[model samples]
Target: MRRAFPWLVLFLLCLGLTPVVFAQSQSELDELRREIAELDEKIDAAEAEKSAVAGDLAVAQEEFYEAAEAVDAAQVKVDAVQAEIDTEEVQLAEIELDLDTFKTALAATEKELTETETRVVDQTAELYMATATQAPLVFEFTDTEEIALSSAYVDDALGNSAELAASLEGLRDQADRERVSLAGAREEQQTLLAALDEKRGRLQTEVDALDEVKQVEAAEMGELQALVDGINANIAAAERHKDGLEADSARIEDELARRAARQREEEQQNDGGGGDGGGAPPPGANGWVRPVPGGVSSGFGYRTHPISGARKLHTGLDMSAGCGEPIYAANGGTVVTASWYGGYGNAIIIDHGGGVATLYAHQTSFAVGSGTSVSAGQVVGYVGTTGYSTGCHLHFEVRLSGTPVDPSPYIP
Candidate 1:
């Protein structure tokens, strides 16, 4: 066991300061407990906040993913619409090329038709003149065979003109039909192109909208994640602080435990060699024995003060003892005082029930408290040099009716 601080014990006994010291210690312990409780509350609050923030962060992340998926879906739709637009554009280009071909053919057919009509009109006029004047009748011919040949030639000429005119009309009709078909195809393609463009526009709009939503949700996720981090940080800090406080509390508790254990040990050691009527040493003439193993170094009478250099009544016998050596009770008695008294630092007084008391002073520490019964040879305290002392020893005294007397008559 560690030795007690004798000076501290002396100071405590001297000025009635033990209770104040203990009260301060108790107050400190209580403060530590209160701070620990408060820290626990803070930690709990921080954990709750962290949990809530984490939940929000999770929700935000889920929403972000959903928005990203929507964006992907919208992009796919836009791509599909663009593909349709490209196809429609190709078809429209082909229809335009067909329309141009049909237009050229129709124009050429109209020109041919016009030229054939003019030729037919001229032929009719020529034939009418011939009929009116009968210019084709054998007047232009030298013989009947020549006249027959001319009539055959005129008939072939009229037949060939009529056939050519009819062929030109049929070609015109065929070209007109092809031109109408090409125009219908071009119109349908243009209509489809316009519708595709409108659909692509709407799909692009949807894509842009979904993309915007995705951006917003992503940003929210970031903020919520940051919040979760901050909350976790707070919780971690609270836990660390709580741990520190708990460590301090544990230290204080350990100190208190040590003190209590020391106290119990001291009590057992002090009471070990004694009972009220048993284990006592054989008493001398007045039921007393030597209080310490160290015999008397100075007797109880005035010669000169060792510290003051003046003659005075020495109140006790200075018994030689090493520092921290136990001082025994001279007889079975009740302890009347176990504290400091003036120049007698860390002293004890025991009354033996007949206006007779024994004093043991300048002790390092007390083994028993006041009002305790002790037997002869039972340990009362350890020796020390305190007030008005030059070295470690016990100042032993015997008192009768509150007056100090020589202790030699009482102890052997």
Candidate 2:
């Protein structure tokens, strides 16, 4: 009964304080559950905010890259235009020199024409005086008395002296000999006048030919002058375009700097890692890449045209690669062109400096864009027909300066 009393007192003490502790524990558990739910909500909200910011950053980066590429293309276009201006300037200089030369020649020719006209007038006058109206007077002397003028003169005029005395014992034989000599002199003078006329006509013909040449030069000078004017106008236009590009480039630079600052701050917040790196390595040991891993269908040089069976200039090497095969760069270079080229379809051109360039044609799609620096053996595009091709093949070209060279010489 004494032990039972002690147990009862202990149970009462426990029962009296147990409910308060249990209630306090339940309140703490509920508060902890509510705190956990709030934390999860905050986490979802933070993740959404991060995703939106990242999207904005990605959009800005894309715009920056596009703007940069456009500016680069504009710069290249401006450079080409400037080069054209330089070429035109040189042409204009040569034209000016030619114009000066032609002008001088024209002046000399005009002087020659005037001299020829004067000579023709003078020669005509001289010929008229020498050939016309001067009919030689034939004097017929009729004498009634037949006197022996000279015995020796009469003998010379006759066939023989004895024959002459038998034939004519008068001075009639001497008069006939004198008449023959005068006729010979008149015939000789007329022959000389005729020869002079022929020479004058030939000279006038030469003069006329020269006059025609001068007229052609005068017409050519007019054309050259017009071309020079057009070239100068183009030069002025190019200068204006350059100025506008410069201003645009300055604005772009300012924007790029601001974007870069923002990117740096964002990077500090998120740490490293930005931009999806999408560039290509260049060609190296494999100087020549298989355009389509197929047989060489045609070589670069003169050959029979497949369509015409006639001799033609084969501008490039043709390979029988399958469609959609990766087209790699033959050497280390930058992609200078990636667009539809004449006869080349969807083509890609790489500039390997030192005035060397290579071309890949008949592409389905390009893996890289213009101005992208590439390494050897890097895939730049895929093979397909998009130009003047009859089949799925790659048209490859090796160029020195701007002239097509034998690709076989460089192929590995």
Candidate 3:
């Protein structure tokens, strides 16, 4: 229902009713007022529904802003967690490179140790065979020549052999120590790498969760923004309707003023003595009667608006009448307006001579049409809760040359 307001506003604005001429009769004037009133009704409806939606739109916009902020915060956390993961990965890569280097060194140390052991085994075997051969010669030799020859061979063979055996033993021990140290270093690197991998995994999990949260918040923000846009469009439609209604009302009022002026001029020319035309009930005069048989519910003056809660002139006296109750004319006059009249729903306006007029508003239906001359206490309409009224009642006003005055002075 709310979405259709914009199209309705456009259609009404395009109507472009013909302009009113000065010589148009009271019936033509009433038709114009009715048309304007119908337009006003549409405008008022659009305005009436806007208040609730506008409030909703405000709340939605606020939520959207909060959601957007939450998304941004979540993104920040995700980025931080990802950064930590990246740092851990880099450390892990370094540890892997160090492990590879340590393995290479261990392979070379083991190969050198194996070669040294092989050389030591070969030297030990040569020494044992020489000792065995020389032992037999020692037992057989009683001559000094044999003894000397055996001794010379032993010394020559024994030269630096013991020292070489000692040096090989030291080399083997050094290789064993290096292997232990390398193994420990590799183990330490592996342990550190495992810890970093675990930390990175945790950070990655955190980042994934934060990303999901951010996506949800962003989606919510998008929905709220769409709602706000829709509400703004509704408000725009209402504003357009209001503008059209004002334009039409101004035209009607100007026409009424013109007609009133013309009537007064003609009356003055005919009287020639500048008589009062037997019009305009003086102060404390008994020229007008009550329009409705009810007590006053509200008196005319400045008061708080019931619907809008703004300070404005009440503009009329509210008579406590029930729905369908007959509304009488305040005095005898021609009906200048008997149609929907802006905030005064289903209104009737009677024009008495001497610039005095009376209005009755918020009627369910009209008893008489425009240009109809009605006598005092004549039923012009039935009470209704139309226009700006809260219930079935008659809004009575007395105007002097189109400006509303206190109806009390004219009603007695």
Counting clashing residue pairs in each candidate, in order, gives 0, 8, 0
lDDT of 2 by residue, 1-412 (tens): 0011222233223223211111122223223222223333333433444444445445544544555555455555445555655565565556556556655655665565566555555555554444334532212223422222223223333423343333332334444454465455445545554555555455555545555544554454454444334434433443444344334433433343354456545854685643212222322254554444566789878998653355988988998877656677777789999876745756899999999899999775676789999876777776766545556678999899999998876656
Please write out the lDDT profile of model 1 over residues 5-39, one tens digit for every residue: 23323222322211212222434654544445545
Superposition TM-score, candidate 3 onto the true structure:
0.50
Candidate 3 residues 11-41, lDDT tens each?
A: 4453444543433333343444455445555
Model 3 regions lying over 4 Å from their true place: 1-115, 118-122, 135-159, 162-284, 293-315, 318-328, 332-336, 351-357, 364-393, 399-406
Candidates by TM-score, descending order: 3, 1, 2
Winner by TM-score = 3
Give candidate 2 misplaced runs (Cα > 4 Å). 1-288, 307-310
| TM-score on alpha carbons, each prediction | 0.46, 0.31, 0.50
RMSD of 1: 22.3
- lDDT winner: 1
- For all the candidates, what are their Cα RMSDs to the real structure? 22.3, 38.1, 10.4
Judged by lDDT against the true structure, how good is candidate 1?
A: 0.71
